[model samples]
Target: MSKVVLVTGGSSGIGKSICDHLSGQGFIVYGTSRNPDSLNTPELPYTLLKLDVVDEENAKQVVKSIVDREGKIDVLINNAGVGITGPVEETPNSEIQKAFNTNFFGPINLMKAAMPYMRDQRKGLIINITSIAGYMGLPYRGIYCATKGALALVSESMQLEAHEFGIDICNLAPGDFNTNIASGRYHAPILEDSAYSRNYEQVLYVVNKQMDDAEDPAQMGIVVEKIIRKKNRKMHYRVGAFMEKFSIRLKQILPDKVFNKLLLNHYKL
Candidate 1:
């Protein structure tokens, strides 16, 4: 039987690309969308399931449905997440809570739900899609970075804990990718009235430019496929533009002040 795989936020962007690529590679891939029917695309190769990762009950049912039919879930990709943009001070508590629920807690719920089955099978893979920003806080995207960073740390702990169970976990942090993420990002409504308003346009411009020049999302799909096929997968993988991936290494060697300066310069802060 083909390996069974589950991917969240599979309606579009990197999630959809991964589903298509893995399905072509002969995996029994199932992709989740908040509203799968909205896609209405006839060409998709993988199965679509309705899921809202923020809803723990729904996540459990989805996994149960998969395991019921497939007998085993070989891989779980926690890719469903939302983006928020604004100064941390200006972002509403509700927005921050919402981000945490979807980006961090949602993955936690799925992991908890799948662990019993995976542990019983004594083997499974969980891939958490994090971000290069998770390594450092970005100016306008502080909340988004925090969410990803939290998930990355959780994934690290999970890997260590699940090792004995014959399970593997990977935190894949990609830099900017050409996706519709920008349009979907939640912007703080107070930006116009805040003191930072004067420079907000410049910040927004830089952010948009980065996305426009971002690497192809399909590249991530290729990288994920390779990782899936590997026998001993690494715990962490970074994929994206050269600088974005290199920045992680640079932070390791550069002095705190030097790295901070470079980061501020990169963002024109």
Candidate 2:
């Protein structure tokens, strides 16, 4: 039987790309958008369902709907997330909590809801789409980095536990990808009078430019398909430019202060 796959945040960006690819490969794919009615793109290769991962009950309902219809969810792609940016001090507590709720807890809710069904089948795959930014604390994006970083760590523990039930949990972190994520992201107002305004503004420009020139979002689809086919799947995977992927390695080998210097120089802070 063809695998039944669920991809969150499927209205656009990486999630859309993944669903397109999987559907092309013959998987029964159900992509989720917070407001599927607004998309009105019935011609899509796969079905689009309504899901807002931040709502636990909504997440459960979506999962149940898939299982009820497909009989099993072979793969669950936790891709729905929000991007947040600002000086850590200037970023409000409410915004910070909201980012965590979406980027961190949201994925957990889906994983929790899907695991029981997956456990019953004793054969399933869960891919949590984290970020390469999670590998370190980039200036001005402290909150975003923290949220993705937290999810990466949490996914590791879940992967270990899932092994017992014949389920595979993996974290696939991507670097900057050409997508419409910039428009949807939360931006703490860049207060001109704030002390960090000049630096924040500079870095914000660089970040957006990176997104503009980044690799095609469709490339992520290819990577996701590759991960799905791997016979010896890894607990974690990364897909990005040479430098973006290298940055993670640099952080691993370089001293804290030296790596910090590299980041400062790169960001021109």
Candidate 3:
């Protein structure tokens, strides 16, 4: 039987690509939007479910609805996330909380909601869409890095915990991808009087340019398909341009000060 897949944030960007690809490949795909009714398009390759990942009860109900309808859910792609950028010192606490709620707690709640069904099935897969940014702290994006980094680590632990129950949890961190994330991301205002103003503005420009020139988000869909097909999967995977993937390795091997210097120079800080 083809796998029944549930993907969050499937209305656009990486999630849409994943949903379209999986549905085309014969998987029963259910993509999610916060307000599915508001979307004008009535036809898509896959079904769209209503979901607000931050809502705990909503998350649980979505899972139940899927299981109740399909009678089984073989895969859950925790692809819902938001981008946030700003100096750590100047960014508001509320904005930081919102980012964490969407990028961090949202994924956790979905996992919590879906795990019991997966445990009962004794065979399930979850692929978390993290980011290359998670591997290191970058200028003006410290909190964004922190949120993804925390999720990456938590996935590590969750995989271990879920293994005994016959479920596999994995993280797939993509580098810059051409997507709507750039437009949707929260960018803290560049205040002229703040100490971080000049540096923050410079770094933010670089970050935005990177997103503008990023490769296709469709590549992420391709990677997710490969992960789903694999029987023996790694605890984590990364997809990006050669240098983007290489940067993760550089962080693993480079001395702290040297790596920090490289980042500062790269961002022209």
Please give the lDDT score for candidate 1.
0.90
Q: TM-score winner between 1 and 3, please give it.
A: 3
Clashing pairs in 2: none
**Candidate 3 local lDDT, 1-269, one digit each (tens):** 99999999999999999999999899999999999999887599998999999999999999999999999889999999998988888889999999999999999999999999999999999999999999999888899999999999999999999999999999999999888987889999988899999898899878778876798988988899999999999988999989999998898999999998989999998
Each prediction's RMSD to truth: 1.2, 0.9, 0.9
Which portions of model 1 miss their true places by more than 4 Å?
none
Kindly provide the TM-score of model 3 when superposed on the true structure, using C-alpha atoms: 0.98
Model 2 segments more than 4 A misplaced:
40-42
**lDDT: worst 10-residue window of model 1:** 190-199
46-148, model 1: which lDDT tens digit per residue?
A: 8999999999999999999999999999999999999998878778899999999999999999999899899999999999999999998778888999999
C-alpha lDDT score of every prediction, in listed order: 0.90, 0.92, 0.93
- What is the number of residue pairs that collide in model 2? 0
Candidate 1 Cα deviation (angstroms), residue 96:
0.3
Q: Please report the TM-score between candidate 1 and the true structure.
A: 0.97
